[model samples]
Target: MVVSPERLAGAPHPLLEGLDAGRAAAPAAVVIFGASGDLTSRKLMPALQALMARQQLAPGTSIVGVGRSDLDHEDFRARMRRAVEQAGDVDERAWAELEGGFRYVSGGYDDGTTYKVLDEVVGDLDRERGTAGNRLHYLSTPPGVFADVVRRLGEVGLHRPALGGEFARVVIEKPFGRDLASAEALDAALHEVLDEDQLYRIDHYLGKETVQNVLALRFANSIFEPVWNRRYVDSVQITVAESEGVGHRAGFYEEAGALRDIVQNHLLQVLALTAMEPPVSMSPQGIRDEKVKALGAVDLLDAAEVSAEVVRARYRGGWVGGAEVPGYLDEDGVAPDSRTETYVAMRLRIDNWRWAGVPFYLRTGKRLPKRMTEVALQFSGVPHLPFAPTQAAELGPNALVLRIQPDEGITLRFGAKVPGQSFDVRSVSMDFSYGAAFLEEAPEAYERLLLDALHGDPTLFIRTDEVRQAWRIVQPLLDAWADDPAPPVDYDAGTWGPEEADRLLAADGRRWRRP
Candidate 1:
């Protein structure tokens, strides 16, 4: 009972098209490294199943899951089926129909011979199925093996132009690197084998519907873009927080913490889109160019300056939802005396003429009161107070909140007269909710990125320099925090963060937004 590709009479969503184009044009087969990992089962496979159920995959497209698991094609398909069923909303027929596309390759990442086998298997698929020599290489594996996999692919000529065909695109997952230097080194390693354009740096945040709506909201509407500058805007805040702790990722979280895990890539991408200038054209490069420029305009925080503006914290034992939880250090795989920061709050400045003097406060953390990701733009108060002192004081500055998750929507707040009040004013809000208004399931972030990678569109994905610029801004802060022997300030798990975080903004006569 799933929709077929043929039934998608109109243009498929832009995201789906991107995935299809990457597959169809190159006669490419998709090889997902780290095929047996949690990401593959929990996200990647589910996304592909959704694409297939929707009939968006290219004709003759083949998928080869690469992992060390000893599973044949049938076994792989069965595993993938369970994954699809568990992670997605699909009918049995959809699962049955999509199962035919599954395949597997088993080997250790360090073995070069694995790439040789991969080359052979891909060639066999092409010869038997009449698929053109195109391939989309997805590295869903750990960041450690990314360079090795890409290099091996190139060594075996798997990434080279096929017989009478073009090159394959390589897609990567998040936590690109540990820091700026490592990120740059990663770029260099990949560049040795793949051209810049052939790389898709996937940060799933950019794939969200609400995030994409940012572009449409700014460009499609005339009412807001004119005021999206320092002239009328007071400040902008981008936040990505989680209600859950590191959970199973404590090992990974020990090294990454919240900054690299979320801010450096996901949050920065949101900031870029929210602050980027309108591109001359909507082509991938044009849009990306504008974003890169915006990142370049981001002012780096000096050590002393960063210490003043930024605050990092560790979550301590506290009741969350009536259940007691241990502190971050007590999490499994975390060092007994680990100093990794689970929370980060920073006041940032963009040096460009458009956003100069605008204090953009960015923060993200785990084990907070609730899960919420949003971008709030606070506009300047009226130039003059035209009402009584009490009435005027009651009016808060206009705020445009773009709720990016949990409840995807846009809300505008303005002052209004309270009913039956003695000329008293109160803040009133008008909202556009995606769920209530559209009543449709928004495509998952991975679904959108998967489609875009298939379609060979790099616009929604981050470019190398964009990644570098983001790291550049945070590298200094990381260095300063490392140099300091002091541990991160501790906060109760259920609360927002440490008191210093409050004072980081309070000193400026401002406060962090509360839900």
Candidate 2:
């Protein structure tokens, strides 16, 4: 069956619905630092290609790759071509169109001459390709060089837009800092070169179709909101688990651990979205303001509380996906005596009126039994059951689970009468899967975030205050963990996590959902 673009676009897909196909971005040049890095080939190039295929990119858009590699324009283009091909299938004409706009500048990040050359190259592209002097600089380099790249851009006048011209923006990758103080320092340095509006702190989680649908599932439907508060909700659990061990990120993971890498940014963002009040409007500031408020309401745990409420663990050698894998210490780049945590589970309380007494449980880890990310809200049981105790023994509290990955969907679990002469009730689920409900495939998270950066929409991107506030919420835990003399608890690679993780919820008279 031939499906029209209009039909496919307007279909009831969670991600594709309400997508504005006609919304055109202004002509701009994207300058990527460390363009030869894995992120560029694996994510950025493919995402840009996908955007081009959808006609979302403006005409005459250009891409400039900056790196220390000794590669000319054609070499970089060929490298990118292989990357895009590895990502997925590409139309020849689409590749050709994007290939035309590709350019390369080889230089060191610490050298001011590099930015000067970049300025000239960008200007030349502007004149030849009609890019209109608007630039979106992407710092795809390591955190150590982020400041250097930004300062160089400022020195070369690339951070400023042309007179009466379009805008200039920069997309910064995550791990904003090692801790609270460093995050503040990075923000200060960034503010010196660019205004807050010109900065886009990218957190890929916010761009997921399921993550964005969090807003729709709560606010768009009237029924869910009235009971969303602590009055009727029992608890909320957010889990991001990976079935595979850290393949080559051992060095990065050794320093970051699961808390700094995932919990501080991604899991916390999901928690805020799940608990935040409805925004006044859907504008970038409108949504972020509410998220900031929710994050600000999180109760900071003291050292004593941390010991009781938080669980940190490292993955020991065991089988995963039917294959035996080495432990974290066994990884190539990891230290044998490293105290880094591969898994973290914590119980949090939002001190706001909406969620005062309710607990928010969060957990994330690598080398788990499955790869899944979800937010589950368990509702309070009915106060008065009109049935016998035995008849309702199998019934459980109703839950609304929002599956963010794997099989993206929403599941509503409630009591359903078991078929018999008796009135016995059992838990049954009604699911809405993205694959089954929508014909259109969901766009990659990077594609959505990159397009937003080009269009100057900060809705999905983290703001300066949001970044600082997230750091603030996690600082106490980081401090406590740093001071503790005990090592992280150990769990087998293929297991869920440490036993302490289960005890975190067990202490509250509840348990985690296997999902």
What total of clashing residue pairs does each candidate reach? 8, 0
In the range 312-340, model 2's lDDT, one tens digit per residue, is 99999999989999998888888878999
Q: After superposition, how far is residue 378 of candidate 2 from its true place, in Å?
A: 0.4
Cα lDDT tens digits for candidate 1, 82-145: 8877885765655665555667888887688888888888888777654478788899888999
> What C-alpha lDDT values do all the predictions have?
0.84, 0.89
Cα error, residue 138 of model 1, in Å, equals: 0.7
Give the TM-scores of the predictions, in the order they appear. 0.93, 0.96
State how far residue 362 of model 2 sits from its true place (Å). 0.4
Q: Which portions of model 2 show Cα errors greater than 4 Å? A: 1-22
- Worst 10-residue lDDT window, candidate 1: 15-24
